[model samples]
Target: MSRAEQPSRRTVLAAVAATAVAAPAVAGGAAPAVAAPGGSSASGATGESGSRRRRPAGQVDHRAWASFRDWRSGTAQGTRAVPGRRPGIAIAAPAGTLDYTDPHTGTTAPWEYAVWTSPVHRLAVPATEVIASWNAETPAGTWIQVELRGTYSDGTDTPWYVMGRWAAGDQDIRRTSVDGQGDGRSSVWTDTFAIDDAATGLRLVACRLRLTLHRRPGTGATPVVRRLGAMGSDIPDRFTVPASVPRLARELVVPRYSQEIHKGRYPEYDNGGEAWCSPTSSQMIIEYWGGRLTEEQLAWVDPSYDDPQVCHAARYTFDHEYAGCGNWPFNAAYAATFRGLQSVVTRLGSLTDLERLIAAGIPVITSQSFLEEELTGAGYGTSGHLMTVIGFTADGDVIANDPASPGNEAVRRVYRRREWENIWLRTKRYNASGKVVSGTGGVCYLYFPAHPSLRQRLALAAVGVR
Candidate 1:
């Protein structure tokens, strides 16, 4: 969907956590409904399915992906299977669907796909292979740029690999282009590095790497892209994650209605026209899980410390920026800490990183701008303000709790998802410091480049929460 439609998209997400899976749609021709490979019925399998599914070692699974066959079609449709020559094996059709099935759950959900081969022949990669391969032809007359960066044990000075070409013919990926030797820029180095692969027993700098694929602007043929998280040569088991549960919610401040005054009705004012538009939305998610800082009791906004104030200073503090308030720690910190918490706030830098986390079953929290007028209404306030919304109402309305409000009554405001998202456009708020802070003059988002150790801590904390 166009960026214009994110609000409507996120509204569906706000309430997914509480809702159960709807009954599966029976497709056109119902094959004799045999029990899925495992003795359990398809219905039964879904019962066992939580937000995530387990995968076997060494195999690549594509099921559970939120696929968009037609970029224009905002909503993802059911899977289409491409059967393999081998019995009980097939590649999912309808483009982008997975071809594998769960041996435990006989029923195969259309979204769950696996890439498999004839029982006799197979594709395998060593845990240490520095190459990648695909049967699909390279987009002819085009360049597919691959970047390699790994984190050495000390967790500093990560470097980019030397430029390499996807050589003419299809060959098993044997080696990575040599390291592009030079004192690389710190931003590139920090993002590309991985944790030491051999570390075990709670490594603070444990294994983590990011592989980004950019669609070369003038590539003649459509590039067929495949990625599964792995280090050097080992391909880690890839799985699909539903997008609804983990999401970003933006509390839009539109003009006229959501005003930004040099001196607004509230105290602790900035030179301001509203601020905290996106930060408010993000804080709602982070604090939702930690369950601190009730709405009625306003936390003190510390000018010195840019982060939120936890109930117990010992537990957490306003001094440090955290990834988000939600249980999902798909933030720059990867865990909740002063270290990496600052990195998760941007709409741009966090885009790809957030996508990878979401693909791995973590929800990302972000806000959208629907119309331009909403900002005027939400007056800019330096006073601490935040709320949490667990889900939506029966009529696709946003059901949220304003910690600023009273008990049980916390569930008062219900908004049309589109209406809420529409508000983002009017306000200009940037993410900065630990929380969303305002500019001396107008609103804008803030960004910071964090260290790898900070990110590792955040990731661990996020995963640990669930």
Candidate 2:
């Protein structure tokens, strides 16, 4: 069915109030006891002989705040002020230009594109995914295309792979179009793109990257690229996790939304809902933190559409090169564009690490692949997909907002801990010849308020987050 003809589903209200629970002890050390807002201890522990416990004079309550606060402000021990880690590496682009002449007008215009090449980055451990992120400001006649090349240990270099061409609105370099006449006017956009064998069949060992910004000069507005960078990781060939670790929290209630219901709604934005898991997951978290697109921002969307913000997200995060919204770092960069929030793309070692983030009131968006049988109740399987890890069950099962669901009501579902772990952390698949191939490994995008509490920082630090 054509996207414009797709049926719109009713918006289901799924906001649930979050409740506080005792902070789990980390690494076998008891977390310092803190008082609840009422000056009472919130340890949830009973006194000796089963008597009701009394608050000690010095106890400070860390669990009272529903939202995270600056940890350095209070007397919380083990807390030191530290800067939040921004994900991805920065690429240095030398100056370059592309000049185009209009066939009809016989007028020539010039566009400047920054060229960035990375130093020899040796992936001693070959990774399955190579990802890039950047922010750009361009007028109607400008766009950006990114390419990559890599050198193997045997001294072979992979051909330059086109990561993507990004611009506002619909004009994409992948298509034959007039110079600089893509979608929308001057606007600032942040995007990300990824390359993997499953999609591109292009793999490399140690690598370098190239970025080009295209523009047609007659337009007065000059194109500007704020920053660009790439990242890669090696995922394990088998699915295995540590025996056990501390359970951080009982439950966290993240707002739920579904992408499947909106499938085929906007083909220009990568066929809308069917390919919008990343943006849909991002929208849920954005609203969770009180961020929303203003009406002016939604003006470009179809007036009759339901939840137009999801469409806005898809458009903002879309990549002309890869042609989808599943880029990990792009979604993170998009989420970070909002005020009072910070996001990064990184890998988590285990479910326990995920538990800590949830315990700190942060929801994580993760990438994974699975067979239909591997993840029960998913109804469908994908070679690549994105979902939000909202919370966990008492027994450590996963509670996620899987946008792949057919309806919003089915978005919030649970999966067995081990089963979910295998699909999420394990990125190896066997080919027809029974040979193992690498997959996008335990990668995730973590979004949280800019000022995390002491506990949140500790959780992030434990996972070796940069």
Candidate 3:
């Protein structure tokens, strides 16, 4: 019941999502599955069929397994579940070894490996798209690979798809997403698993994640995976989303550092500050939670750089193959590298979701693409960008710590609610040339303390990401 090993351990985990019922980490031996709101059949309206039709509230299903017991519930082969202040899974022994050639470096090396498979997860909401994210520490000699195997509504299983092969450091293996992978039914676009055509009445009904932990042969080193999970949703495809009423209009005071200042500083890391939005947003949240890099950690940066941590973040998060620091999961994983923090990459249904978390004092990082004319008051345009939603204005407008600014003092800006929502939530849009393109579809990254207060847990649960 296994694929032949080429070769690919850890004690890492993520938390429960807003609406994911804490069941056995996988399916079949845990809490009974809870259906998503309205529970539509798997083969219907992923998002395209009823573009204008009002859909049920809360369409996304988020699930993660981070508890020691949760890790023990999964199927393990040469893997061990470690229980402690933070529970996670780690390599027990090498079940096999495989030769991995760094496509970025064209160097081949053999690595010892172990496997841990989550129990089947029956999605309360059958989805057209799924994104998997993990929080782990892959030291100098170790890394991990995450893959998803899905079951369609018709009872067919998908070929296992590689979600990502990653490490905190690039020396071992360049963290990268596999390209040109698909089975004609589903395709992995960057970090996402998307139905090739959701409009065909096809949907992913259930899925399981397989974690492959890798380390240099004969080394005791092992990656510890502290958090791992996926968010699956069938969001409607629309250029515009209905306006949400203003709620909880208070902004959290978050430190801001503009990426613009670092422009051209290190062109190798995604062409420097002009494109360091993702890492900048991540560093803000990491510091907000009291995570700081020791002076020793910042020693490598040039002595003259201001806010050197920003530059450090940019370098650490740069995905060589993607050639950008904007890789969603990579940023989240980078945030988790800080002490006492865990992060996830999931989609939010509405601004209300952001409000709930903000009420509990959690800031959100959102991804969107827009033209200069689309988002009024913003002086620039970007094919894609990352901004931190620290709070809302009294009138419900978004108050974001945008990194694309002239200076840190000007990093925070108020964006029109309607324009912001449409740009971030829509799955389709038109480029400047009037050519149709894809939107971010409400994709966001959530970072919080490893142990949260009850109120924080409730808010995260309500928002469908814990």
Candidate 4:
């Protein structure tokens, strides 16, 4: 599970070579603005720092630590903030070592570790749920753990819950999300930390993230964390969300690769590619940003296989505990491992946010679930699925690169805007079995160049990412 370099497959990857983050940042002019969650216009707007707000902010609030200043702002114990094109924190010296028994494999080993705790960030929108994500590179003998502690509206604090214990390679440890973590009032549902009784009006008013970087005892190797953040939202519990009027007509020529093509290819990775919608969608957008796998890096794949990169993605992004490649942050962190790219997991208010990103030449990966009849033209349905939003048709319909297709040739699908939006942004839904279930609530992954264009940064800022 150790990657010297992760490989990827391609159907129509762009020829743009990866660029350096130090290359001149194009930022003198005003940041571009996206439609404020319900329209189609690419208009004028400012970043979070600007006094003239782009528009009313959405229900989701994303706060992450990435810049050198942001890294230095955090309280570090055995860690030191490393400054570079992308500022990060690393272990200057180990705080101590502890023996950890693998819950899944039952292998006990001693690991040197260091901790970094972020400054408390009060949520602009007090949320009933919060999901944390981080981007890091863990060497063969190293890994990292992310945890969250929050203060509820009543002023009581929640215990530190382990959000994830992750490694890029599974050689040292199996990447997993800890279960059975809760405080009578709230709980961790796999990757998300949620309030148990949101109807009581209890909400997460603020939270802090704790990052622990782990390495083998007596090794100089360490995990370097480039980005860490979380999304907190209080999406209304409803089967439907207010619909948006699509105003943009544009399409990005993103690559198309299907997860169905690799069904049963690697059963060890979450029962094979049949459930690889997350990684497949990630790989498509990664290639769209000029990220590619070299032949030498792809040496691990079976020569008889087609699109070995998809196989590679599925294997690397697979979460052992979840037994699937659908871990939202794991997929985002996987995409960030590529050269000159940064990725984050956040929520958008509506498809209008998507249109703004597409207009800025960046494609988005969205998570949604639907009944077979809820969506037209999609022959199958699932409790969850991921698709790449490449563009919009002249009629404002969503132009998506759905990896659930039968083959790469049928990957580009046009889903009605209303149907796609409702399925993606709603917080509640009814299953085919006539049971109430949870929806994605606008969760998505945004990947872009480390040094984005003026327009790209503006588009991102407009969506409250800066």
Candidate 5:
């Protein structure tokens, strides 16, 4: 479908304006409750410590990019292979061709791709992860592959790195999953490739990305790409906090959804339910604001599934290269593709800052590593996992839509606020067996509707949300 003809899949809900109200601080806390304009105040008492408080909204440092080339302007170099093909950043004749064989199915079909060398993006701020993300749709045998390289301060570029090939149910670039012709169909998918210096042996000081889209020749299925971009962040390995820090709010309420309930329903998408935390969390917030996939949009999914959109989300966000849908920027980028929404990946400094976002009605998807004992009631543990920060409890505990739960009804549960903070904000954690597990300090994905209020804008600005 053409950009103008793409179906609207969800009902539009009015954006909630932030409310400003003074929240009472804990008896000996150092930081006062600073609510965003129009943001709601938390009913719980705030915590205090001599640690540095969160920076004012405007002073926080972060960065995000929505697209690599101007699609509407045709600035990106590529052919308009088919009529009704969206104008910008599409693959066509000359640069892209349709004569390639599907690696998974061996089916030949018409295929095309566009290549762009992005303007040098400077990562002046030290960053640990370079995330390459894009939005696109391809037919049964088509797919997208993204590669990235970094320019260091010395003006040297690293070797091109394959981010991933986003085809149906493909594995990570290293090919860990069993390869196959996945649920032969076409759908928009978003994915991210993380660049860590420790693994790549290159300092990601500055960078650029290369994208290639492919399809089976003569099939007549045209690949549609709407947006492509990259995000870089230097989240610390560990967060430092004083011995005692107070809570930020009494309670805030966000919606809930679980991934465990759908386990084994769609193995093609990362063995089905076990690997869908990212998309499940994304779906909860999307539905919270009245967003949903229409029956037509989800028609590709098997009807036996209960929440087809979750299945759709898993397939749409599946990273052929990574073999998982939990790519950070990809999840945020996927949320951005929906009408009325925008998203970005950044790190929060403290729970105090997180409370500010919750107060402003924005739910946060956070990455953490924890042992079962470290996080009580979670029922399971992981080396790395994602969960939604929907609200805080009366005692400042965390209320979230933990998809790891066995069922949807049990998705919303509270964790000890401080313990949750340690797992969330601090990077170092222990696994269930008390083995030391390093972390990605305070990294989170923030998504919300566009045209935010001033305070909402401030909250977004603090996280470098564009």
Candidate 6:
């Protein structure tokens, strides 16, 4: 469909605000229009470098393009900015192409190509070759990192360096220059690249660019950040998300804790059949494991009490008057609810996040005494029933601890990735915005300690864990 014909899929008022070369980027703000190339952005054209390039006008399959773009745009906004000074970036790809999924809603959507090409902030002749051109500052010194990504006919994706680079004394050119306009020190960088593939005639099909402030972290000191200050051009017509990169995290691990049906042998918090066993089981890992999870991720573990947006809380752990864990210790619901029985585990990108948590050697289990104290103090009941997490196998299998089961209190349950996700996703209850809950007040937050072990950091890198 033409950009104007594109229907609103998932998200609203978010497109072409930020962008890149062959990857993907949306507008930086809610401007009136998304910017596009002043000249034709068709497949066959001259690049910014003025090199004659002939690419398969059909390089990006049209249907696939729609799918990709729709998915990314519909997702919750990541880091974004209001239109101010920087020339808003734009996404360039074979029209109507983007294939990605919304990690939050579990919905599959496509991109709005024409909308992406339309600029929201300042307009660059062609959105692809140039994102935002501005100046920014850093602590070590001012540097730049122009975000760009692309894929070759051989299916090899371009590295971060392909879009731009940085060097010493010269102020990192890789960063988005925001201060070129003197007096006001903003930082922005120009994106420069040539489509060169003589063999297959495959010009750069898709390119996404991001103008980011590159901050060098300091030892025993907080890293400094540069904000986008000013813009050099007028906002464009529209904006969007071009799918030049796959949506795989550096490291993504789903750690399963305890599993129980609401109707199963568990105490119902509100006498509702829905069981809180699995949610309880997962909490152990969140508390124990260490990583940088978004607020949404944390909420998925322990939903809030009043408005369980993403997930539901079985009941208040400390409130004993109602059906609480303090009463049915032997029941499945009781085992999962007891804060004392809580044990944490790691679900990290590389085995490293896990290994680091293990190396910390902090006792993973809360002692039986600790459990009793929590229950009595919080007014939770305690039946004889107990739940345990035997451990996880190297290949990602759950070795669970079910005290109620015969002989095999701990057994390995091999579940397909699809089935596991299905079960977990189905239990999710949502608010209007679809955020996950964490506590009684409905407030949500995530914690990432600065002093993580080196092993944990290294492991996170391996899995592209952010």
lDDT tens digits, residue span 29-116, model 5 = 1111222223221111111211112232421233322332233322345534232322224455436564544455565545555564
Number of the top-ranking candidate, with lDDT as the measure? 4
lDDT for model 3, please.
0.78
* lDDT tens digits, residue span 1-466, model 3: 1001100000000111101223311111111122112211111122221111123245788778777766887899999999887889999999999999999999999999999998887787899889999999787888999999999999999999998888876767888877767777777766778877666789998888999999999999898999898888898778888888988889898899999889888898977887788999998988787777766677778889898889988887887766778778888988887656778998888889889999988899998878888999888776778899999999899999999888999998999998998888887777666755567778899988777766777777776664
Error of 1 at 284 (Å): 3.8
Each prediction's TM-score versus the true structure: 0.25, 0.62, 0.86, 0.87, 0.69, 0.22
Q: Taking the candidates one at a time, how many backbone clashes does each contain?
A: 72, 7, 28, 1, 23, 116
Candidate 4 segments whose C-alpha is farther than 4 A from its true place: 1-58
Question: Which of candidates 4 and 6 reaches a greater lDDT?
Answer: 4
Off by over 4 Å in 5: 1-62, 67-75, 79-101, 108-110, 135-144, 167-202, 212-227, 239-253, 299-305, 432-434
Q: Model 2: runs farther than 4 Å from truth?
A: 1-96, 100-109, 116-129, 135-142, 147-151, 154-162, 168-228, 239-246, 339-343, 429-439, 448-458
**103 in model 3: Cα distance from truth in Å?**
1.1
lDDT of 4 by residue, 1-466 (tens): 2111111110001001101111210011111121112222122332332211223375888777777777777788789999876778998899999999888899999999999998887787899889898888776788999999999998999999999998877777888988768767777767778777676799998888999999998889888898888888888888988888887999999899999989888899977777788999998988887777766556788999999889888887888877778888888888877757778888998889999999999899998888878889888777778899999999999999999899999999999899999999987777665756677788899988766777887888878775
Rate residue 394 of model 1 by lDDT: 42
**lDDT, residue 306, model 5:** 81
The local distance difference test score of model 2 is 0.53
| Pick by TM-score: 2 or 4, better one | 4
Worst 10 contiguous positions by lDDT, candidate 3: 3-12
Query: Could you tell me how far off, in angstroms, the CA of residue 206 lies in candidate 1 after the best superposition?
Result: 18
- lDDT, residue 433, model 6: 34
Ten-residue region with minimum lDDT total, candidate 6: 438-447
Superposed Cα deviation of residue 464, candidate 4 (Å): 1.4
Which is superior by lDDT, 1 or 5?
5
RMSD of each: 23.9, 16.4, 11.6, 11.1, 14.9, 22.9
Candidate 5 to truth, TM: 0.69
Regarding lDDT, does 5 or 6 come out ahead? 5
Best by TM-score: 4
Q: What shift in Å separates residue 236 of candidate 2 from its native position after superposition?
A: 3.6
